[model samples]
Target: MTPTPDPPATLCEAFQRTVAARPQEPALLALAGTALTWAQYAERVASVAAALRHLGVRRGEPVALMLTNRPEFHVADCAALHLGAVPFSLYNSLPADQIHDLLANTAARLVVTERRFLPVLHAAAAGTSVRYLVTVDQVDQTPEEGVLTLEEAEARAPRPFELAAALDCVGPDDLVTLIHTSGTTGRPKAVEITHRAMLSQLSGSQQVLKVTDQDSHISFLPAAHIADRWGSHYTNLLCGTRLTCLDDITRLSEALALVRPTLFGAVPSVWQRMRTTLEGALAEADPGLRALAEEALATGRRHAPRRWKGVLTQAERKELDGADAVLAELRRRVGLDRARVCITGAAPAPEGLQEFFHALGLPLTDAWGMSELSGIALIAPPGMPRPGTVGRPVPGAEIRIADDGELLVRAPFLMRGYRGESELTARTIDAAGWLHTGDLAAVDAQGDIRIIDRKKDLIINTGGQNMAPARIEGVLRESTPLIAHAVVIGDGRPYNVALLVPDREAVTAWARRTGIATAAPWDTHGAELAAAFAGAVADANARLSRAERIRVHEVIADEWAPGGPELTVTLKVRRAAVTGRYADLVETLYRRGAADR
Candidate 1:
């Protein structure tokens, strides 16, 4: 079936519509007390546009962004968009090498960034096409030797930037952004999404979310990720949802309490941590109150199905009402009391994750989508969220389960192609136009989809964070000569851990420095080797995100060789074979916990 066309010709048009409707409404808010009305945001965007236009930026040009979740990011991105330029964001956690590769691929001459990322940006910009480094923070202060500031850009506007005339620069087919994600084999693939596709996704999301100017959202994820762009940023342009920019993920708790967002979403790890905290507090509460809370949750679980079906009897409704009363305080304390719909995406939620929240008077809906689809293509309908299933395809998306169980999707929001990878794009979307999602999934009678397993080798951590294991393993090999081979393990786990095969000769040589005898666990020499492995792991982790860092590692006493159980004939690490052989060891590594990294 042909997917529905977006009502707006382009995202620029949708944004203008929203601005007209909510000109005076709070469009963007900073956790630090800065707020911008829609009109003000448009003004700032136009100012940036004038600056970029002056800098010779034109239609189809790429403008890279390395920013935290800040309002300035919105301004810079919109400025690029209205100028008919493509604005793509690089993951803030990406190492200098990866950032450089992305910049080279996009040929982005201009990059809008902040001080925190300037060092990496400067390093990455070396020998690349980058000519302008626009800093978001330190607006009026002296920037790095050759960088311009965000305020300077706005001040350089030749005249009041005209939004109306500038809107004519681009159309729906124009590329909007490039979402960089892990490819099937380990390299990063930049998924190309156009304005039309994103607008379609926003429309489909609106059918379920029903979001409007009344809705307020917390921007927690990096703008580089598709979830943040689709869930918060693009939604603003189409639905007039207010955005609270949370620059630092660590401060999400305080920001949540401060903003009390009406529509919020987080990865499973965040929800899991909340559950742990809630359980820990309940364990320490007064005995009588704790008992009441447990009983209320139990009652809630028993009748939640009836509530979802809207067939709850009077007695059942009263019981649930009491349960709601019992958990209301808990909800408010977590700043989720006002949340009409909460979502978990990027990875499958752990079993019973949905039940825990539903029992607590909160509806935690799970959705499934990838970078290629823009976002939120398949969502567990908030009205009837079922455990384990990511519900039916959203309006305007068609889904089918292939004979091999691979989930296939066709939607207006689907990506046009990968940036500079036409062959890969052709492989992903076949002649029929169905995107092979590479996920093993099942469709129930109700058209709900339950993801069973992944067909690819990418690792998605507990917090719904995705990373390429091959990239990490490559870094590990470079981190230290003592490591013979490194197998990263963190698929659906709380954090990353690694199995490191040590080169015996190299370990023994390194042991000479520490005056250790053998690499035996009983010997003090073992501690020295473990410490060495730890150091290498730390070095590699310095280039990764918190979610991608290896928490614990086990140095394998046995060295791996080509064609061995853990290695291919080509000397590559056979990931599944290595993990399968050391399943117990990997489990032990995770049991050591996520803080040791």
Candidate 2:
């Protein structure tokens, strides 16, 4: 491997150079259907930076960002970098108390947020030291009593920096981005990501995904997460690509069609939910239409090339081309035809899902990394995907497994360490500069990594038994019309208990076939489909141990809500949240004593 290239002196100047080179090009597309040219983007960033400096935001001080995915977020972030103040993201949905704690913990004086979220800042800032709050939205909604509008704040100040010298003090080792972990178990710790670390991630992603100036991204994912921060934001900035950030999930589909992006980042749940929606909708329609849809999908899957398998022959190629028309129509409906690549990260997506999309002609590439590594650790090459595996380590990164099943990573892209927690920082990152990723994983013969699960999530029963819920969930997902996600609840009790969130449409269709009359819908649907889910649960139980078996459980109609203990912004379950939310339900599952069996 060649020595890594040097990083730019400052992240802000790099953007300015790019804008100067491509002023008229589209730099950002917002969920509101608004587009910003590189020139416009640069102007906004400059104004915001100047405004921040005038407000006495000093270099090296932290500026907390609490806005959702919007155009202001980009401008505010770029502007903060220009002012040489490290920008940290706080989950916009975090409870006001938690938000206040984070603000005090990070010692941030300046905060940027949307008008709607100002109440949270008000409540959280009651006794905290956060002195100024700037609302990022364009609406003239009544600003909180003391907080100012981001626009007004900027208008009051002069341009902060006229040239590179003003930003020359920001070196590669200086903090560029500070991301906080999803504080499920404890208070969230700020991860210091330096310019060098971010550049390392950007370079690796560019090489692996072959991102170019022509590339376009739909950036609705929370900028708080490293996956979205690097893959959807910084990568686009570094490669001179265009980014489209949407307001919410409702606007995402429209944004996709409008932007017709070449590259986008997604989590597995999004892909799975979309697939389930399409399949269930088609299945419920008339027999002829359902058959036609299934045939089209199957045909597409048949023609799609397998990543792990060898290349197809000439005859195979011809057959796939013949089915191109049907597949193209299907792709358009799914809004993925324009996408050259869809990168999935944060969690392991089922391999079969990746193949299904590939068959439809969308290359769904899987990547692996953590918040500590700034996101890009490994990724699959286009058309060379290995399903279930998180591809190989990104360029300039190294991965190794310990004797005890822990995955370790060493890269310049690694964070500077957990902020203010020297003990945890020392424990997570070793003297050798390797991050001890607490995930259990294996590197295959082909150098692909298949992560099993977090070592911490491992279940240790009272009977001295250990089990991985992820493995059990994987097996349960194999069932036709599969489960969305399952959380095993039994720990100290005699056996495991799983609280399953069923694929509602699938279960509803199964009900229609089984002749179950449905009167009140949605809320009562879970109870109505209890018997069906039980049968599936029983089948899964047969494969588990006495301690690991899910003896009894309940079904939830919809997924857990984000910010509602059960789900993270990326839609991953906080196990503690899930267990705590349904503690009574879990206990009811095993209410009957072990002797009863």
Candidate 3:
């Protein structure tokens, strides 16, 4: 692979270079067939920067953004960066009070949002430093006391935008953004990322991705999440990658087909859904066709590891040669035909999930990172992915396993510190500069890292049997696509039980195929639905050890979505929230043993 050139001193400089180098290239895209050229994107950023200056925004001030994934978000965020101001995105799913905490913590006085979120923002802004509500879209163009549309802000801008002057003041160590972690344990803490750290991590990640201007990305996940921020915004700023930002994540499948991006990244759940979709369709296919597809998958898997090692025999090479053609069609059907690299991280995927994608000719790369590192610390090397491990560390990351199995990282990508929490930050990052990542991990002799679980999330039963809840949950999700989410419970209990949220589409299809039609509203407690879940749970348990298996399970009645109580915007399960929300149900399951089922 060719070496990447030296990274710019700051992202603002990188953006300037990209705009000068590829002015006519498509930079930002929308689903409605709208495109913004690199020059137009830069123009938008300048306009926003001018408007911000007019509103009294200055260097070192925090600007909070709360909006959907659109070209406007990129424009506004880049505007803040150029102004030497810190720009941070909030999860649209966050509650008014959480927004209150974030604004108070950042001491941000301005919030960029649309009219839909005004009610929530108004409540959050009370008794805080928040003084302005700049809406991207509002019904009335007229300005209110503390609220105005984006157009009005631009209209009030002073002549001769001093964007260049502002950019000149920015430095490498200056704070670029504040990314809040998905607080599974407590309140989300804002991670302070600097220009130097973002640049370092991005350049290091290129060793694995080798990202280039020819690449394209479709953005659906929340920009608040580090993964999407890096994939959609940062990559485009530095590498000139084309970006298609979607407003709604539910339409991700439709957008994927439309963009057919060269680079695709998602949480492990998305890959599981794709695996299930193809498997479900094949389950009902003609016997001959099903057999042929199965044989192709088997052949692909048999050749994948050998090919990854560059050790294919003549006959094995011929077998893969035949299977790849069939697998290529499958890739096209799933809208990954143009994909050069597919990445999955943010959570653990079941052991076989990666191999499943490899069996279809796409190497589903396992990755590992966190908000503290600004994402992508370790990733499976392109074309040489290992199924069960998040591969070797990227260029600048130095990793070591602590005595108690916690992973410690010393990297240029490390965050400056947690925002407004110096004491907590001191506890997290030791005096030696090694960030104590609370994840339990084991590094194999090959230098590949296998994440066991979060150090605090491991379950130890009353009888002293210990296991990782993530591994069990992963196995359950992989047993069938019908199960969308699984929460395992047993910390100090006698045995484990699970709460399963089934996929509505997959479950409906299964019910139709089995002729077990619902008489009334869809009921998760219905005998037929229970039977289906029972089968899936049994299948999953077969793959787990006796201690790790679920003794009893309850299927969730309602579908859990990204913005819901059960899931973070990035689609990671909020274990505490789920367990707390269903405390009564969990207690009931324990009171009435597995015999009750």
Top TM-score model: 3
User: Which sections of candidate 3 miss by over 4 Å?
Assistant: 1-6, 141-143, 284-288, 518-521, 594-597
Model 2: per-residue Cα lDDT over 362-449, one tens digit each:
7788888888998778788766776788888889899889998899999978999899889999999999988998899888897788
Q: Which has the higher TM-score value, candidate number 2 or candidate number 3?
A: 3
Best by lDDT: 3
**Each prediction's Cα lDDT score?**
0.80, 0.76, 0.87
* 363-454: candidate 3 lDDT, tens digit per residue: 78899999999888988887889977999899999999999999999999899998888999999999999999999999888879999999
Rank ordering of all candidates by TM-score, starting from the highest: 3, 2, 1
Ten contiguous residues minimizing lDDT sum, candidate 1: 562-571
- Tens-place lDDT per residue, model 1, 306-340, is 78778999999887897888888889878888988
Candidate 1 segments whose C-alpha is farther than 4 A from its true place: 1-6, 139-145, 183-185, 457-597
Please give the lDDT score for candidate 2.
0.76
TM-score of 2: 0.91
| Per-residue lDDT of 459 in model 2 | 79
State how far residue 33 of model 2 sits from its true place (Å): 4.4
Residue 178 of model 3, lDDT score: 92
